[model samples]
Target: MQPVEGSDKAEILKNAAAHVAKAASSGSKIIVLPEYFNSPFGSQYLPEYAETLLPSPPKQDEAPTFYALSTIAAENKVYLIGGSIPEFNPQTKKHYNTSLIFDPEGNLLAAYRKAHLFDVDIPGRVTYYESEYLDSGNKLGLVDLPDYGKIAVAICYDIRFPELATIATRKGAFALIYPSAFPIATGSIHWRLLAQARALDNQLYVVLCGPARDTRGTLVAWGHSLVVDPMAQVVVEAEEKETIVEWELDPNEIEGTRKSIPVSAQRRFDIYPDVSAGTIQFEDPKLEEP
Candidate 1:
């Protein structure tokens, strides 16, 4: 959705509230929004928009965005994965692209600071460096949804790193969800491929939510919000319009795929070190590419 002219915090949040309510009315138990849902997908404005949540002040007046998400989750009784937010880190004096999850009770469940900062120089195409302004997360995140079981989560660029999904799969995550904003340059080609690769390799379901296409700004987004099944097929997708595409996932598919391939059980750990834990050693291991 395009932000209204001179978008204020309240208006940005009200727009989100409307979407959440609509999803709930359609019987969606779990709702996911696109990355940078409330703010424009630009780096310069991050500091101005970043805010804190729950456990702290962010000031006496709570961060309006946080309050809005929590209220919506509780009132609607829907599990909400609030897309990415620019977060201010006081202790480190840095900022991060952060994703937050809220339970139906309006309680904070999980937080994943985007680890793989988007930095690519596709000369003649598009160039962006999230590392220039955003601090990277040092760890991976996994959250368990009561009736639904475990689900792994990462932001846009983080999806390109297979290690994140591998670790989550080992920890029993049957599905993965990413809130993303794929710029037109890369999204046109790589968006769906990455989603399909992650799901196929892990034998799990993969869901992605992205902002609908809007040509007003200098930057353009490839808008094809989608979900992939364990079978590695695009189950449902949305056009450039602002709409919700919902689908049900079956765990049996995951079991069946893994059982047929058996790649998860047949890993040759003796030949290569396990990456499932995704631990970081004191010195980063460096190797030349194959």
Candidate 2:
């Protein structure tokens, strides 16, 4: 893993490509990078970092992270999840916290914008208000692969919501990947627990990739990146330092677990009164039309 420093787009892309090349040489078929591996954090510089949608080439002065990711995927003949990047939306003229996936052939397979923005006031001590900078995504993201089966993606804060994972599972995702930059305070308390709980509850593999420690000291993130199996067993975990973790996932286990528990088929939605409750309430009819 490359511990990216500063927001120099070219340098970060070069480092990431080198890491992916090294891993590919070592026989890794799939690689996942940490969240915002392409850009710097904080809401201040988001406008400058956002990338346009696919088929529309990124600006010449833009960082090479996205292009490098696609090239690496094609060159290494490996599946690459381009972690989370700041993406520009043509319609809204705003940026989004987004994740994109590429196939071995360099085809854009899937993309996801963070649905749950990280907006919280940490008891008057520290606060992270992501909603102020990012626009939330409305749809869940899933991609299908012949070898890995169906894989779902969720960004950092999305892990806190089980409904997102549930929706992914309902979409036939056998594995879930989370690219996060969880702060030290919350990560220390809930990171591993949330990953384990999501895996066990969904009976699917969960892979988490987190950024290395930040020296800024203000929003330092915990770096316990890990991969958990369907039974909530840890396959590989990274220490506090920069690291790369690789593991072979078995799809047969997903089939077996679902057959054994059959929880998906046994869901008692009929008995749940609030299952159909409207979550989005609008104050006016104009607000309801989009």
Candidate 3:
């Protein structure tokens, strides 16, 4: 969906809620928004729009965004992948780009701070330095839903790193979702290529949600929200406009693709060591209803 640059937080919440509700009505199990859904992109607005991650229902003014997202997810009864937010990490005394996941019951399931900071300069084309204000996250973000298989959440620039997605796949992730916003300069060149490559390499579904192009903002988001199947097929995609995209994914397709290719099993472990050398821990995630 499109965002009016510097729009009121209340208005942004309203727009997001409306879009999410529409998507749920269409039988979408999981809904994702673009990075900086409630604020303008870039580091300039981090000081103004960043919010702290707190328990639900703080003093009226505390965390309207988090509460709004939880309430919307519960009311709609759908998994919510809240794009990215500039989060104030009290412990670090700095900000980070964060992604929050809420279950259908509105419980906060997982929070993933973006590890990859986008700091690049293209001379006359475009120059962005996310590292100037945003601190990078060290850990990865992977979660498992009751019905759906595991999922890995990666914010914008994280899409460029396949190692994160590879690690998630080793942990049995069936799909990967990236909430991203690429300026028109890079979007035209890398957006589709990256989406297709990730899906093809991981043999999993890839869902990329991008902000719509807004002329009012300097960061020209290449708005083309898309979904790619395990076979690297573009099943459904949205144009450069405000729209809700929904599609039914058949799990058999995943099984069929894996069985036919079997690249996952045929990996030359002797030549390429297993990435599963890392530690593993399972938490009985609190499933209490909200």
The candidate that wins on TM-score is: 3
Tell me the tens digit of each residue's lDDT in model 1 across 26-138: 88888888887777667777777888653442443646677688899999999888887888766665677877788899877777778898899998789998888888877
CA RMSD per model (angstroms):
5.6, 5.1, 3.2
**lDDT by residue for model 3 over 76-167, one digit each (tens)?**
99889888787776666678787878899998787778889999998777898887788887777787877687788889889999988888
Pairs that collide, model 3 = none
lDDT by residue for model 2 (1-290), tens: 52544577778787888888888999988788888877776677678777765434455445356667889999999999888888766677777787878889877677777889998887844588887768888766677876767788889899989877876776678888999888787888888999999998899999989877776745777887899998888878887777677787888887888898888788787886432244532111010111
Report the Cα lDDT for candidate 2.
0.77
Regions of candidate 2 where Cα sits further than 4 Å from its true position: 54-63, 90-93, 273-290
The pairs that clash in candidate 2 are: none
Q: How does each model score on TM-score?
A: 0.90, 0.87, 0.92
Clashes of each: 0, 0, 0
lDDT of each: 0.78, 0.77, 0.80
Q: Which stretches of candidate 1 lie over 4 Å from their true place?
A: 1-6, 54-62, 91-93, 278-290
Q: Per-residue error at 53 for model 1, in Å?
A: 3.5
Candidate 2 lDDT at 7 equals: 73
